[model samples]
Target: MPGAHGGSQLPLFSLTIMESVLDAIHARYAPVDARVAEILENIRRDCRALERESRNQGNERQVEEFIDRLRAEFGERVVIERQRLSAWAVRTTRWNYLFTVRGDSTDRIVLVAHYDTWRGPGADDNTTGEEIVKQYLLADLRAARRPALTHTYFLAGSEECGLVGLSSQLLLALGLQAANLALTQQNWLWAVVAAALAPLAGYRFGVSGSREYVKTLSTEQLRRIRGVVSVDSVGEGRLYIPRGTLGADFLHALIPFGDYDSINDLLEEAAHLHGIKYNNYLAGGTTDHVSFLEVNNGLWVRGREAARRVAARLARRPYTPPLRVPATALVAMLPGKASPLVFGGKIHTPRDTPDRVYPGPLRETLLILDYFFHRLDGGARVGEPRNLDEFHYARLYRTAAGHLLALKDAVEPNRRNVNGVYRATATVEGKRGIATVRDLVGWGVETRLRDQVAEICAQLGLTWERERIDELEVIGDDARLHFARHLTPFQRLAKASHRAIAAVQSVVRNWIFLTFFALAWVLAQVFGWALDVAFSLSTPFALWVAEHTVLTLIAVVAVEIAILLYMMARRIPTWIDNAYRHENRADNLGSLRRVRDQTLR
Candidate 1:
């Protein structure tokens, strides 16, 4: 999964799921003599505890307790590491631990899960994620067969605070956890990140703010990454991920873990292959992986909402050809296939707890992610997501469940074929957005209006003919589909005017300049002013008003003139010159008039 690296669609955990993980780990403990929360109560009872344990340090006791509890639950399989940071905040020190099933190979892949949650008891946000990772760790040790890729494992504390523990101590602790100098010395550390931030590499990435969870391709250093798969809420409550988009290409299979859990959910699997079942994780909050996506230099896949925006604008079709839909909508649909689910609900209230989650169809989500990540990491090479039959087909497709029996093999999120219409076609299809295939076809058809835009550009004496947009126009049958071509000249003019307005409005009506205008108005109101300076007579009140108003107006104009002079310093003509020329051209055109009378008929 995505972790602090770029060149990926998703950045892993750039925000706040840390607290949730911590909360889950916290709940797993009874603190020896002190009963979990009771211990916290005791600690809080003491002022020294508050002083010595202030948020970070106090969390350490909780961390230690969690390590002990995990040890009890998973036995010697859990490796806990504690670091005392005396140099930083007063009593604050970070404790990070790595949990690996004994006999786990360094040659195998790594499962990176941060055990830190933010603020309070974050159950859905990440307690579930933390629990899944910890359970996976234990299950990894107890399982009769270790996963193909298992390079030890890890957990972090204080992830809520910029992933400092994960970034620093965890790397060292993994070595100590494995008890092998070579394990941490020269091993490839690949990961399957749960939570919103998935691993990044291909088109499927992460998103911020929205549930889609994509990362900037430009955010991380990509030398160490192998592959990534994340789960997030595809906007509009749909779930998706970008797999085979050529602009952001990907392998075509999701791993199959028979049972679903957060740890395995990101890899994408339709059914139980290898005892792993896909389960949908009830998610809330962000993940630590976001900081790691598109690790080099890239942006997230365009969002569905953004695509919808372009689609809405296309529906308007106010002259400018709405031919860009195919590309624009496709770009926006880039991140969903890999994301988990999202809901529009108020947060932090008591109503949000495990009891609120109903167990329905989440198994595929867990199965898919785990399978995708492992396979991408090397459980399987980049190819079609196959079933037990090796039939190379997708079984767990998104249909109204049980409705599909035969044709479910084709929609592997990564198998797209745009052979004809446009060689480079983008598709923005999500759960809800993908409801209509006809809509997609229509979008592709409407995208052909580039011809009109090219024509308009040519008429304007612009150098746009050789451009790609100029070379292509989506051609379709006019009988049933007549798309509007070319933007109206008035719209073109309004756009031009708006552009000019944005660029020059600052100077034209700046508050500082407007202050001068206001002063002019004040003078006019108080003493009476005239717009025409030459026509003013010698009435005392009018003379005073005119003098002050003109003086203020002149000063404002002079400032603008100074700004123009500054801009002209670069040897380019000032925009003021253009503004003046436009006005002059309008005046010249206005001066010539031919009056013609026509009959009403």
Candidate 2:
């Protein structure tokens, strides 16, 4: 097994696949998840409904109707928060909406998309994403029997005029966590006139359209979070991102891309009907994912990875911490395209409507939705899901590779030589199809090669970083680690007893703290209040006493070091005999055992 519990090897409750189930909820996919289509129609209907309300024909009637309809459909899941903006067409202009579906989890992941537009339906700019998310949410909600998470949101608004409501929503979300305080208080602090600019400065940068978005997402947090996946400005066309080659042998993708099995997975499918290429775009900025990198430094460490280990330790019926280290390992950007089928066969425009949005991306979106469900059902651990020795453990080791790659890229921007690896300038080969030191070791395997690897490591002075002759399997868990298996039964018993004794000794640790506290109190009283009372005036006397004491202590340490070095230099026989008084080490313990054995003989 790669990355699973050893018990049955196959995880309990098998992975959950809720894609079709969700599609059914929205009535989108035909014959099964027809709800998908239904969900799309609803998006268009909602947009038109909002437009009608804005037209002043219905006035407040339309606004109230819209909210009531949403509450009726979504039930208690949707919550509303009101705000007043200084600049508005009318007083107390309600400018925003945040829809949500909670799950049964402690941590929250925010996935935001806007739905508002200045005019013409504003479909492709966001209508596409809005529909996709709505369908996804409807599908997720249909299966209410499954667990639900809280505090996550689906935010939609018209970004054409300005970010407006979205900014406040984000600030509230991040502020609560960043300042280790309530979201309301943190916002008040951030919005206050006297608060320094530095604490929440990350909002000013990101891939978003805002100039001062820090009130929303902080740059420091973005840098510190585990990972981010973005989807933006996609329609009929294939998804594309430009990632230069890491090495000649490495693939075009610098890291894992989406939930697809392979590039060919995207190249073929119902999407094939539309003829899209989900290829790398190389260098272009359309959506807001760049903001994640632009602000919030970069959450390089893994969050999912840590959570997985923790959840595994809990193992449900009653939760418990795992015996392993945990951290986040993967972050991604998921930018979706607009509907291939919409009004007038266009997207991201008022003309972009439910009639023309394609089914392909929707299907893909459903599949991703299924991935989230499956991850939750089986416990969302980092890396490929499998048994103990299989994928999971391998990822634990590969997680280190992320940090290494980051370091390598930073140090070798020109793809020059890495720390110990041969660079473009240093690599040499006299013939084509020839192997150099760069080739994979096991394939060109030999004892001599391993010896050479060790030799090269020693030469480079990075044996630890490069490789060691010792098999890593020795450190592998699910078996023995650190200690050898060859010890006799008696030795094992004795060693176990020794460890038990040490564990028992640990119970009295508080005694050390109590002793230190008692001594400190005694010194404070003797040299503090009593002396002050005796002197009747303390300032000059206390200062003078400390100076002499501090200087004398430093002088005593200097004298001791000097005397020790002098004895060593002269090779003098000092009276001191340095020996470790241990029962298990090579000296007294061995002697005692030998003596006992001889006496028995």
Candidate 3:
């Protein structure tokens, strides 16, 4: 058959031959078998003890021992390397074991699994993933002939707490500075603050590890990459594939990143072709495959720009764009269960022991991956890239609508108190009611909307400024008038209430200064009264004239100056707001066009 690479004929394998090979491998390493069970138990015991003691050193030593064993068994066929990562005041060491089966081509297929545990035995969370990698390597070694592709087995560390090990390696490979992945006290504080004030501030904290990981790959390497399959939590239940980093629609709506559409399609195709019963859906939670998807959809750059803009606004500084890296999509996954928001419920707890993992799913996962790898080795491409602008714009609009609906529900509870006003302001035809905080939020959901619109416009080869949208007549005066004119009496009451409160606050602030002037006038009167009584007794006309005329004029001038200063101080905030708005209004065409060109290509 025709192949994707240089029109070269692709290698095809019979189903019977593939199944026979996978069956032989599965029989020996099935989770219930004595040999495999023993290995898994040992891993669980070591990881559980080390995690309890908080000893990453022990974990490193354990991983090193595993690598040493592999080296001894495979001899020259397996190449091993150790990578030491330092980030966030912590140091970690991870290993990469490459199993070379010299092929006609130089393309590489990467299989990844993290060996570290969060807590408990972690038999299902990741011990299953590690064992799968080892079993696959063994099968590769025992094969009588060379395979069609080279395989790189990346056994990572520190994945439970953060994707530090994987992210650091990717960063260093692409010549970028590795970020601090440690969750510090300050990070936790900000997380709390962000959660508490999320409604009003509309800010999200931290960066995606997957996004950073993808950004650290060069263009050539990305092109050469056949696929990156992450094996995680496959010890129990059926084989499952998640759509992207965020498995659920709500989570994706809130913070959209990563795009695994192409990879997911490939995996499903493989399953169907092999007659493997597998579960595929928009599952919840994340795994290492996310790193690839984040770059595939171009959401990582969007996220980075959003964060940079928020920081620049807060710090009152100009935002300078960071370094750029080329991107692609070649990530897939192997996991257990088919839950919407979780993989294995026992994970991260003591219940996640080896006994909870079923042998059937483990065997099925291995089969699926074997089929996927072989298909990729045959020079199969993951199809054309998705239109990221269309994808993101649809999600943006949906999320905005969701937020408005939620706001409406919150206000509905208090409707009875304002029912009369609501009726009074109802439209003549009664099709629409009044404007609440929801209307305000919907109209002002500008940050992501503006960014997405700018991106879409740039992709169309049009020069667009953010403020230009607001200038359009359809959305300008007409929309505002329409919203105001049809407001239910309740909405008008709410709006009037807001204005009244603001006006009261303004008067109260001015009155504070006015009180000082009043106090000064009273003091002057008292002093003048005392001076008059004393001067009358002593017959001093000059002192009495100075107190009545010059002193009084000086006090009046001082009060007037104080009033002027207060008025100017009130305008200071407005000046700052206007300046910020103006800065953002600058045409974003250049940067957006470059991004569009780079990502779409």
Candidate 4:
């Protein structure tokens, strides 16, 4: 390598000294390709062996054996914790292994890999991740100098089954039950009910393991964490640096997680510097990194407080304030050769064997990670706290408001025609007459249009501030007008009727008094006879109803089921239309843009 600094070549003697230093640095953590291959093979073999043992005994035996192996390899530095998780009436125990490497500074870099496999040998799915972490640890152990940042390797179990291990641990550590965390103090009764149902809710939500270990950490220790990198499925194919979990925009809006952009930027820089080919992806499914990001951000506390305020207002109860936590948390991941949008390859299949994974890509991935860790440990900036509310506002403004504007423009000619007709039909003969009524109706329609626009914006998570409504008025008219343009004249009239109906429904849906009135009407028409029958014990009809109790119960159940089906039929079409629109918007917005082959000189 040339010894140059800022375009100035060094003296021959200085060049020689620089070469020696560079050679020493390279030697410190250089991984032999053959050795890496051998380690991966051994891991696959061990997994297969334990899997056989599992068949003889139970699946827990395989998990235990894997834990024992970690203890043997990492020795005293390894700490293991057991977690109990229940899902769908089946209870299982999973373990999380932590391998701590002390360094000069308390600031730490956490690396995670899930060792649990799905249906198969799981060689490419996660054996590669385990090998990568193990190699990094071995390299650190062998280096002459202590690392600048402490490194913690978190080996998570049971990631395949809906993040059970990850979510359970995080919830436990945060002193939260899955359901009650979303309830407020004003909702004490509801909170109690939620708590009682937490276990079943937790299981359905796939809550289960690493957070238990996180809970054990002191506040100082937690704050010292610099970044978390989850290594997964890197045995073959192209390397990918995942930014976040895909299709989690809704969950993220409610409970903000720390941004991973900084970590992603660093990964790209490191890969380019090391001449590694890679892609930036939003992972289709989540990994262990999600747990770390969610725990560190602490925005769930703020979200719960907002929920509490709303609950208090609704119930006319005293509000309880929420504690604030800083949202500067960073998390990133390196997934093995896989599709970002769909599950591709032989992952979770019996065909995901050792031979399927290539050593060349594995070694390359390790090198890229090595460079990434070095840069990160050198005090590179890792995270930027995001304003999630602002992000949602911008997105809504762009997608919903932009569409509304486009639709408004598309119907501009029609609006002009209608205005022209109103102006032309005005007669000054006797009295205002037809023109006066038309003008009044037109004014009402215009007012309703603006209000509807504001209401739609509010429903989409934007504040109904006057300035924002004014901005929308400037940009476009009501969204219904835009959508109505695509319909035939009769269809457009029908749409107008539908809008009127919807407006009335919205009033009844939103106002507590109106909702109660509607409920009372439904009870009077549908359930009053049943209640009357129960009350009139002395009547012949009541005696007949008591005689055929099972038949009456079945009839009531059938009616309820029929009502549910009708409601679903009315909603499903609208849901599908919205889904298509969202997909189209995503495609137009370039959410899946890729940066490829941009290596630095």
Off by over 4 Å in 2: 1-35, 47-66, 73-78, 82-94, 146-151, 161-235, 240-277, 282-285, 288-295, 298-355, 376-601
Candidate 3 vs 4: which has more TM-score: 4
Q: Estimate each model's TM-score.
A: 0.32, 0.36, 0.43, 0.46
Q: Which candidate is the best by TM-score?
A: 4
Model 1 TM-score is 0.32
Query: In candidate 3, what are the lDDT values of residues 337-422, reduced to their tens digit?
Result: 32212344466665666666655455445555755766666733222111112111111112211211111010111110000000
**Model 1 poorest 10 in a row by lDDT:** 324-333
Pairs that collide in candidate 4 are 164-208, 165-208, 165-209, 168-207, 168-208, 169-209, 169-211, 170-211, 233-336, 234-336
**Top-lDDT candidate index:** 4
| Model 1: CA > 4 A from native | 1-63, 69-78, 83-93, 101-108, 161-286, 294-351, 360-362, 373-601
lDDT of 1 by residue, 1-601 (tens): 2111101222112122243432232333222123222322322332233244344445456546667777777666545544332222111124445544433333333344443333333333333334444444555556566555443343444334234322332443343334333343543332212111222212221111111112212212132233323222211121222221111111111111111122222232222222221112211123323323322212223244456668878898533321110000000111111122213231222222343222211222333334443443344322222221211111111221111111111122222100011111212232111111111111110111233223333444433221111011121122111111234577557546654643562243212223333544465454323435433554675566566987866765576555543333211222322332343222222111112212222
Ten contiguous residues minimizing lDDT sum, candidate 4: 415-424
Name the TM-score of candidate 3: 0.43
Model 2 weakest 10-residue run by lDDT: 403-412
**Candidate 1: Cα lDDT at 182:** 33
Candidate 4, superposed: residue stretches over 4 Å from native: 1-26, 55-93, 162-207, 246-258, 296-299, 302-344, 379-601
